[model samples]
Target: MPIPERFLDELMARTDIVDLVSESVRLTKKGSSYWGCCPFHSEKTPSFHVVPDRQIYKCFGCGKGGGAINFVMELENLSFWDAVSVLAKRAGMTMPESFGGSPDAQKRREKMLELNRRAALAFHRWLYAPEGAHGLDYLRRRGLSPGTLTRFGLGFAPDTWDALIQEMAKQGYDKRDLLDAGLAVSNKDGRIYDRFRNRVIFPIIDVRGGVIGFGGRVMDDSTPKYLNSPDTPVYNKSRNIFALNIAKKSKAGRVILTEGYMDTIALHQAGFDNAVASLGTSLTEEHAQLLSRYFKDAILSYDGDGAGIAAAQRAIPILEKAGLKVRVLRVTGAKDPDEFIKTHGRDAFARLLDKSENQVDYRLAQLQSKFDLTDDAQKVAFLQEAAQLIAARPSAVEREIYGGHAAQMAGITSESMAQEVSRALRHRLRKEKKQQERRDLAPAAQLQPKARSLRYDNIRSARAEEGVLRLLLLDPALLSRMDDLEGQEFSSPLLGRAFDALRGQAQQGLSPNLASLAQIFTGEEMDHLAQVASQPESAANGPRALTDYISIIRGEGLRRSQEQGDDLLLAMQKKYQKSKAYMEEKP
Candidate 1:
């Protein structure tokens, strides 16, 4: 059931958007408003604003804006209803007791969380029981202290299909719920069983410290040695790092990103608590952006092998794009962090961390290793590849410093190398220009970024439609000024949808503000709404300004239809001028 409007009103009343956002983003007092780096998009400057009087936050960069609840939904990735429930809990208000029936997405999430907690408890107990003796012995042999095991919530699943299923059932959970939580798999015959059997379980935790999923390592020589929980309603593997829930709390300003759970566990047990790893996958853009939100630096400590080198190379651009200071950890005497920590001990590994090289140095070294500079042809080839790398640097100073190093290595002058790099930079710019030109040739492509759609036959019509929406948001009664404009008259679907929402609200005698519309729009749409609503306006000029905007919108509409024939376009405009139901649809 939907929550009561009064409750939501009270919830917002109790919540200060500036206080809520300040918990994550470092917002500074700027005049009457607060400002910070936008959470929605990557930017070096502060464009995100929180206005207390309006109780709305808007990012001028990515254009996302809304009240405190919408901020929570976007940042925490919760549903509108779920965000309300969370705020209700934080405010110490009870959910409406009569609001029970079937489970909504939020309720299902709560159930899944409870189920995972119980499953973790049962698995942890089983690791110490007689049935789990083999797993216990294995961990002991690997030198895992009792405290380390408890800290990580390490567990063992029995080598039977029904072990966890039967245990969870005894705790009042249904079999279907377990399957939905990705704890059990159903066969072709519809017989359900536990997903992980006879394996050591490592719980994957979110930054909030909830057990979202599990990663299992087989006890014996099994095929596909590691198995992870698939994407459930609660667990998305790509968005989380294995130990970030713990590492995010560390005083260390940087995080050590590794490959597997065991490597991360080993680093933590060895006093490197800031280490984290992805679950059975390579680094991703999501992972990079997530890490970017917390730490300014990341030390990638993948295995010291061929594949690991390639992986780190691929990950460098992604992490850099997310605005992180990245360095590569070169492990020696062992393949991975786990092996290195075991073989060299903690102090030696600490020395390696201090000696880690920045990404540019690592890349140059890797490329240099591929060629011997003594060969003239090979030196030219090396300089060409190295020049491209130098050209990719965002700063001219950085390119000069790194470019000189490359030039020296190739036994040439730095000025020669700079010329080569400059040529590459120009070539890259030209390529980008051509690609953008090709996109401009397609009218739909030009409209995609603005309208978030390509249905607009003309750019002028789309811009006018955008202007109309902005004016309506600023003064909702401007909607009355647009009584002759049909929802279908807007070329962009987003504008059309916004018009429809405004018409519905005006019809019902409720003012539709960003707060009221937060539940209705997607996060991107909210950003656009925020950007539009942020446009400077005045009450004195609102009506006259709205009339001008409406004229332009209608004029553009007629112009777009003129190719069909001027007579038809004029007749349509004449009818629209006299039309009263243009703001709403007729039955």
Candidate 2:
């Protein structure tokens, strides 16, 4: 059964959007709303606004917005019911016995989680069994202690293909479920088999400690050294990292990001509990945001090879953009963290961590390696690139400090480096200013939906439809003034569907709010609705404005139905004049 509308209304009323969003985003009061950098996307300016009056948030930069539930959904990467449950817990309300959403969807999600859990247990047991002797020998040889192996729920897949499939079947899970959970794969001959045969398994648990997926590493050199779970109903590799479940509670105060699961395990074993790694992928913006929620700083402990250095360079801006203070670790005399810890012992590894360089210095050192300081031309080339890098620093103090280091390295005066950086900064500013000017010249572009798939085809009709939605959201009672209109009258299908949904709620004596409508709308649709609600709508003139909007919509619907090409331009001009006249009266 679906959650009752009355219960949702009360839940939304009890939950404060400001308090919920403020926990993750630092918000500052700006007029009637609170503003902050968007968590959904990286932005320097405060384009994310939380409107306490409407109990919703809208990000002008990313075009993501919704009520508290939607905020939880986006920020936490949870489904609708899961997000609702989170908000319910926060508001101290008991979830209804049967939560809302498709029962099949909920069942499939629960089944996948349960199947992963069972498979993890089976794999763990197998690691200690005779069939997993090879896998066990590999981990022990790498200096992993028995307790460390157990703590991470480390396991081993037997060499045979159907070990997991057979084990799951005995537990009432079929081949289909195994495939859905990413535990098995199918071949061309219509045969199904395990996906992680002859590999040591690492269970990928979420922050909440649910086994959502798995990562497997081969004992010997293979074509693909590691195999990770494909994206499933419960797991997305780009959005999750290895060992974050344990790392989130670390008192170490920062996360040490490595490249592979073994390095993360080794660090944890050596008492650095905050170590994490991406699951067979490079660092992503989502990964950065997720890490930022737990740690304010991150140290990149990627390998010392060319690929690792390139990866670190790619990750620096993403982490910085997500508001994490980033530093780079250079593991000398060792290829990776696992090897470094094993060779020099834990204390020496700790010393290396303590001496990790900030991203600017690391980047400068990397650049220095590429050019010969003895050659004046190469030195000048190096300084030019260094000036651009230093100029990109958000802090003037950082730019000035790093500028001096680059100057000394190239045998130039500090003032000379500063001047070059200043020039670069000026060029960047001019470029940004011109871009802003272009945007300002096309003011209508800002009014369009951020998602290209949702853009309005008929601008004149969409504008009127937006006004109708804004007014209705401001005052559901104004829905009565829309008696002669129908949702199908709106030109845009998305807007029409929104109109129908909101009208249905108001007509049914329910408050027409985003929370009430969320169950029926997609995330993008909810974002668009929240954007509409955030727009200025006059309460006193809502009834009058609504009447005008309805006229425009109905007239457009009739004109569109007629398919008269000759009169199309004339009708559009008339609508424009009417809209212009209404806008002029708004003062």
Candidate 3:
């Protein structure tokens, strides 16, 4: 069953979209909206905009536009109803008594989480016993102290086949639970065997510290050295980090991002408390968004190999999209974070952290090392990629400075590099425009109609009126005095309707919460309104807030009537003038 609309409404009402999104993507105010590199796609430039006044987000590049519920649905890959349930639970709502999935589905999901938790504990226990001697010895040789191993919940998998299967059975967990948790594999012969064997296990924990799954590395010099658990009910590789449980507690606004669990452990143990690693996957948008939440800055401390540089490059766009200030840390004389910490010690590693470069700086250095600046043809080829990278920064000043550096490096004129950067920017914009056009051309699309669309300037006027309404509704004592709306006037039809709704609800002793009003309008309408209402109004205006509001609202009403070619606006003005004249004469 779909979650009740009223329940969903209440959820949106209680939640701040900025707070909700900021918990994933680190957002900074840009003009009237928030801009970040989109977590939904790989992009050098930030085109994702969240207009909180309207409770909607739109990525100009990906064309993914929707409200809070849509964000949860896309981010979690949940159905609309399931996403609603998540928000409802967050809002402390009981879901309107009768809605959502069957009790059986909920029970099955809970069972899967229990099974995974049990398996993680079992693996940890095995690491200490004699059966896990080889794996334990391997960890010790790698310089993992007992405290370090225990901090990450490092464990061992017995080499013997079916050990996990038998162990799970002893705990009274069914074979189905093992399969559901991705801890065991069933053969054609119908025998289940442990998926992880003779390996040192690293349990992957979510921000909540739940053991979602595990990543196992072989003790021997085996090919395909690592094995990660498949997606289960409670765990998804795309949405998890290896050490977020610890990193989230750190005071540092900077996080050291590594590629593997061991590297993360070494850094953390060496006193770089904000180290985190991806869960056996390439850095994903979800990872970027998650990190951006806790830290404003991140330093890429990956291995100093060809593969490592490639991985860092891939991660840069994702991190940028999450609105994180990124820097690449080159750990000289060391292969990885673990090696660097061992050789240089924590104090030296901290110095390296201070020397980290921004994404553009690192990219230029990394690319310049490979490209032959002496060769004119190679320089031209290099400029193509470099220009594209520089074009991604939103600030015009930053782009010009980088363009000059690129010009100097290539021994070309600054004007020439500037032209190339402009060309690249235009090409990207055109491509995005074409994609948006295609989406609009789709059969099921509801392309925005110009009339109802709120322009940037209209946003301010609409917001002023909304602020008055929200303040009045939030404080019931102010509602009774709202009769003298001296200067309060709605800017757009949506705001006018919203104000009317608020007034009616207040008169009937009903709460005029924004979330309840969201269900009554289109997503675009809600987004515009939210941005307006949540945004800070003119601070210089002072007590004129009421006066300016009435002017905007009455003007909008007259403007709408004029657009319709109606004489009602004129008649209303005449009636008002006549009433004022008669009142003066009687007095």
lDDT of 1: 0.79
Q: What lDDT is obtained when candidate 2 is compared to the true structure?
A: 0.87
Structural similarity to truth (TM-score) of each candidate: 0.83, 0.85, 0.69
Order the candidate numbers by lDDT, best to worst. Answer: 2, 1, 3
Q: List the residue pairs that clash in candidate 1.
A: 63-527, 64-527
Weakest 10 consecutive residues of candidate 1 by summed lDDT: 578-587
Per-residue lDDT over 1-587 for candidate 1, one digit per residue giving the tens place of the 0 to 100 score: 55555556667777778888876676889887888777666655678898876678998666678777788887777888778777778888876646642228788899898899889989999999998999999888877899999999999999998999999889999899888989999999999999999999898888887889999998678777999999987788777789999998888889999888888888999999999988788888778767877788889898778988998998888787766899999987888777887888899999999899989989999999999889998988999999889888878899899999998888899999999999988888899899988977887554444434334565666666766666665567666666657777776676778778766765666555466566667777776666655555565676666566666666766777788897888886786565424433422
Off by over 4 Å in 2: 1-32, 72-101, 342-348, 451-468, 477-497, 537-587
Worst 10 residues of 3 by lDDT: 443-452
Clashes of each: 2, 0, 21
Cα lDDT for residue 515, candidate 2: 73
Candidate 3: tens digits of C-alpha lDDT, residues 1-587 = 64444455457777777777776665779876797766666555677788766566777666655668767766666545555666778878665436534444555666776777788888889989999888888888989899988888899999888888888899888777888889888999998778898888998877866777889998767866999999976788988888998999899888889988888888888887899988878999878867766887889988878999999999987787666789998888887768877888878888888988778978887878879989988888899989998997788898899998888888899999999999999998899999989977863323222234544235545555666765654454455434434332355566667677666655666555544553455555654554444444543433345444545555555555566555787864554455344434431
lDDT of 2 by residue, 339-406 (tens): 88788999999998999999999999999999999999999899999999999988899999999999
Q: What is the lDDT of residue 245 in candidate 2?
A: 93
Query: Residue 5 of model 3: what lDDT?
Result: 44
Clashes of 1: 2
